[model samples]
Target chain A: MTGRLSNKKEKSIIEAARKRFAHYGFSKVTMEEIATDVEMGKASLYYYFTTKERLFQAVIAVEQQEFVREVESILQKNILAAQKLHEYVGKRLRYFQELLNLGTLSVHSFFNIKSVFKKSFNNFEKQELLLLTRILSEGRATKEFNNKLPKETAIVLLHILQGLRLRTLKKIKGQQLDEKSYKNLQKEMTLAIDIFIKGIKR
Target chain B: MTGRLSNKKEKSIIEAARKRFAHYGFSKVTMEEIATDVEMGKASLYYYFTTKERLFQAVIAVEQQEFVREVESILQKNILAAQKLHEYVGKRLRYFQELLNLGTLSVHSFFNIKSVFKKSFNNFEKQELLLLTRILSEGRATKEFNNKLPKETAIVLLHILQGLRLRTLKKIKGQQLDEKSYKNLQKEMTLAIDIFIKGIKR
Candidate 1:
């Protein structure tokens, strides 16, 4: 009972903190404000999260988990591998845009704390690679793909996606990922994936 | 006669500055040092180039011109489109590695002056797009490539290459682009180009 109650308390804290951070940004939001919003003592909030960065990471983790769950569902769907790959690209772009819009940090701030967030980013990449590998393997197994090296292709694809995102972000430096730019990026990514699909298709 | 002599003087100064900057980096190397190396007075160096930054830009322009000349020569060669593309990719990687190794600026310093260098970078990209479009168009005209939108494909390809480079640099932040990483990048880029070639082939 005590464990369950503590979990509930932690969840509420994270929820309160997310809203605060999203509204005011990571540097602007304070732990005391979060505690006040959560109706918890500052000391109790500290017990849950040692630092604001830690809390920010927790929020990001939750968001990442949600994205993974969605991707996993798509993976489980009975569909053509090509369709899955397209869906993955579309979802990946949307998720990334949403993440950029999280308001907890601007694009510049995110880069500023890159070292602090490197661990989470690495974890996310691993998860993404596994998901992509499974998709590629499925396609090959179904004889829908002719690529002899699914794992290598998956790794390359991941790097390509990351590179594309970085380019877009750099182009719009200091500004939020606006709708027009997002659509432009979406179109280019979709086309790039189309070419990749053709390359690997039997 | 005076105009020609001035042009020659400026060229010599730029050459001397390039050598100094490459050896000592931008911060360590001074305009006075470059003037001394070129056997000119500080006033004469100022007449030729206003600032260290301007001299750095001149050096970069010269390097960019050399790379472009090499690429153009490859374009003029009698070869299959596939071979030409593979050659282009190989040359691009090697040239970029050389640029990184110039010792004139570390990756971190390059990023620090990103805004200042934006104009030169933009010019290079425009030149690259034009060259890539030519290749794609040539391939299409010969019926060696099937891509319908040569220009669009060129733009996407440029972004992809940029993205890949950014990802690699991020992976090795704060360190020089070492030989091993260069080899790894070369391998991955070669494979990427192969996939791209397969995608566009007739």
Candidate 2:
């Protein structure tokens, strides 16, 4: 029972840290602050994760792993390539919205973590690109998509999705985005995707 | 002759300071460091700009004004809205490339400036949004673009452009992008614009 309690405490600490880091960014956040938020001694926090950097990296790793798993599960299900693409885009956007709602999609923190874990981040990005490429390739073979540069198209789609996600978050934070504005964004995204698919169709 | 010489000195100081701030970011740059680069006394540097923050703001302001002017000139030309958008997009992308090459588009510096001049920056953003909305309204009225949410579409386009600029810079630094990759980015931008225009047309 004590071991289980300790494990739960560690999990709570990590959750609090992720929220803090995402809200304040890595450079601005301190271990002691996170420790206080978690209601644990700083030393106890250190015992769980040797350093602030490591702790932040671990948090990001876990998030990325979970994201990849969700995406992979969707992709692995047997479906038409077009339907798979639609699901893929929908899932990614929905996940992004959830993160934004949780205040875990801060651009500053995202870039900070990228710099700190450049190699690992790059590897993760490459894997994402590969998955996208596979989807595009399958779509083309099945005549669900037009033949075009898969990697290039994938990057474009990723950028658009990311852009939409950030804008949605900004709007929610009263940064020139309101409900009406958000709805417009959704419409534009849908149109953009439709146009892209249409342009590339054989 | 004396006024001319002083003007030359001021220009040199601004140029040197711009380079230092761009490379090292505002937090890391020092007045003395900028002075040394321009072979001027630190006191003399102070005569031109009262504080580092002011100097940094001045640097961005000058560039911002020039960028606005260039974009305005492109928009004001008597041409079809489609041609205008094409020029606008191409010119903006090129400007971002030039800024990135000059090391003036660092994410760190952008955030620093954003924090330092939050109100002013917000005002600038609003003005930019207005400009985009005007262009989109014109495009739709002229049947150059499909009728859609101008503001939301503008926000998405702006974000994508910014992301592409950052990604391109990262690639140039031997970090993530390559020549082929950059060409692909350009292609995607072209494709995105084409689809947007097509999707909006009646």
Candidate 3:
């Protein structure tokens, strides 16, 4: 019962911190403010999270878990592999946008917390690669795609998509992502995916 | 004649600064060091190029001009559009490697001179887009590729390649690029280009 209660407390702390960080950004949000918002003592909040960066990371971890779960669900659907890949791109892009918003980070600010973000991102990237590999393998097994090297193809595709995401992020610099920028990214991804699918078709 | 001498002096200064910057990186190399290397007084160096950043930009501008010239030469070769693209990728990757070496920049250092670099890169990107469009249009004209939209396809392709380049750059962090990493990037780019060609072919 004590263990469960501690877990609950941790989750609640993360939840409250996420809102604060999202609203005012990582730099602007304070642990004191989060503690006050949670109606907890600052010392108790520290017990749950050693630092603000740690709490932000926990929030990102939760987001990453949710994203992976969604991707898994998409894979489980009985759609064609090409359709699955397309769906993955759309969903992945949305998740990226949300992740950016969650941190409210500028390019300069991103560097400040890059080490923390990178730690979380590396694990998420492994999950993504596994998911993509599975999609390609299933596509090949179904004979919906004829690419001899599914894993290799997946690696290339992921890199291309990442490249696209980085380009869009850089173009926006520190500005809040607007509808036009988001739509342009979607359009580019769609075209890239279309070419990828056609290239892999038998 | 005075104009010609001034231009020659400026070229020599940029040449000297490029070597220093490449060997010692931007942050470490001082204006005095570059001036000493070029046998010009600090005041004289300032008269030609006011800041180290401007001198570095001039060095990059020259590199960019040379890279464009090489690409144009590749385009002039009488070969299949697919072959031209493959050659372009090979040459482009090498140029990217050189650019990385030219600055000796870590990711952190990159941010310091990012505005200056971005100004040069933006112009280079435009030229790259136009060249890619021309390749696609010519391929379509010859019935080697059936894509209806050359410019759009070019945009997507450039974005993907940029994504790949950024990914590789990030992987090395601040470490000098190794042979293995360079080879891995080459392999990935080769696979990506093959798939791209297959996708766009008539």
Candidate 4:
């Protein structure tokens, strides 16, 4: 996962695999085909990814990294807690759309790998819940949000986000996300966040 | 779909298919096997369902019937709008658990036949939204709830419900719904309803 040459090779492998897997799906794509596409011998590809599943996991993890980075930056912003909540939720929705478009992950894909990646997914959710809870706590402290149930509220907010993500992804199954769909997706996301803001404001 | 003999035959087929599909998933279960279980000729089975996909939809429809009945009953209740919303959401979560336990339908199964059953599912959701919107509208009329966007709020609530359903269903994927997980699911559902109630109250 480190050193310049090794990193470059791994990145190319993942990039190639993402396209292959997206087009053919995880079950259809083969390790030999990935190696040939990457112009690397089969053995070297195995050196980076022990199996087809591991390669899929690596590709998914790459997607998760971008999400984590975006979330961390939003959490560190010096802004009102309410404003941060809005921004965080918007960014979360956008990334989800991107994820579906890229075919890096979706509800179906997640379900397919649920048992394999349960611990990793749960940890990622807990981290996200922690950040949201912090924002709610800050909002409560500043009297911008009702303080009685910040922790519980954050968790529910995550559930709602998951719901939106699942709903949107369902719409996009076996279809492409287009310009018009983008507008509608944004409109729905904004309305949900507005409702949440209404609910949270003191 | 009526008449005692006709209804009994259809019910038997659905019951047998549900058991087969739940134990082996849609991909593994076959029309011939379902017919054998029902002790009917394979050709006669086709009289009920044109294809395996149609049979799957019928099995899912039976599950949908129970859910629709529950929602209709809740909507007809003489209760405050806020209380009605709480009850509707609680019932929604309970039905979702029942749905997973029945294994008659799932996010994955839905995705698999999304194109085939899109119309039916859309109609079902439209009815659900209409009921929720009516409740929100009544709340606004009585000044018991904020009502700037009744229709949109109802839609978002449905999305959140989908989220909780997806979350709960995801946990039960490739596993059973253990007792502790059920308690946690109930707790989470309660918190989500409390937040929604807070958000809508004037």
Error of 1 at A159 (Å): 0.5
* Comparison by TM-score, 2 against 4, better one: 4
Comparing only chain B with the true structure, the TM-scores of all models are 0.87, 0.70, 0.89, 0.77
TM-score-best of 1 and 3:
1
Ranking by TM-score: 1, 3, 4, 2
Query: What TM-score goes with each of the models?
Result: 0.89, 0.62, 0.87, 0.72
- DockQ, per-model, please? 0.81, 0.22, 0.77, 0.52
Highest lDDT model number: 3
DockQ of 1: 0.81
Instruction: Look at candidate 4 and give me any clashing residue pairs.
Output: A163-B163
Q: Could you tell me how far off, in angstroms, the CA of residue A181 lies in candidate 1 after the best superposition?
A: 1.4
Candidate 4 residue A143 C-alpha distance from true site, Å:
2.5
| Per-residue lDDT of model 2, residues A1-202, tens digit only | 2352258777787788788866665566788999999888999999988887667666666676777887788778888765666777776655554444433444334554456567756777777777778888888877777756777777777766666654555445523234676566566566556655655666
lDDT tens digits, residue span A116-171, model 1:
67777788989999999999999999999998999999988888899999989878
Q: Across residues B1-202, which tens digit of lDDT does each residue of candidate 1 receive?
A: 2353358777888788778766666567778888888888899889877877777777777888888999999899999878887888888887776666554335346555557667777889899899999999999999999999999998888888888888777777645688888887887787778888888988
TM-score of chain B of 3: 0.89
The window of 10 residues in a row where model 3 chain A has the poorest summed lDDT is A104-113
Sorted on DockQ, best first, the list reads 1, 3, 4, 2
Report the number of the highest-TM-score candidate.
Answer: 1
For candidate 2, list the clashing residue pairs, or say none. Answer: A146-A200, B146-B200, B146-B201, B171-B177
Q: How do the residues B146-201 of candidate 4 rate in per-residue lDDT, one tens digit apiece?
A: 85899988887787777776676666664556677777777877777666767788
Candidate 2 segments whose C-alpha is farther than 4 A from its true place:
A1-83, A97-123, A142-144, A163-195, A198-202, B1-48, B101-116, B167-188
Q: Could you give candidate 4's per-residue lDDT for residues A21-89 as a string of tens digits?
A: 767666667899999998999999999888877787777677777788887787788888878888887
Q: Which is better, 1 or 2, measured by lDDT?
A: 1
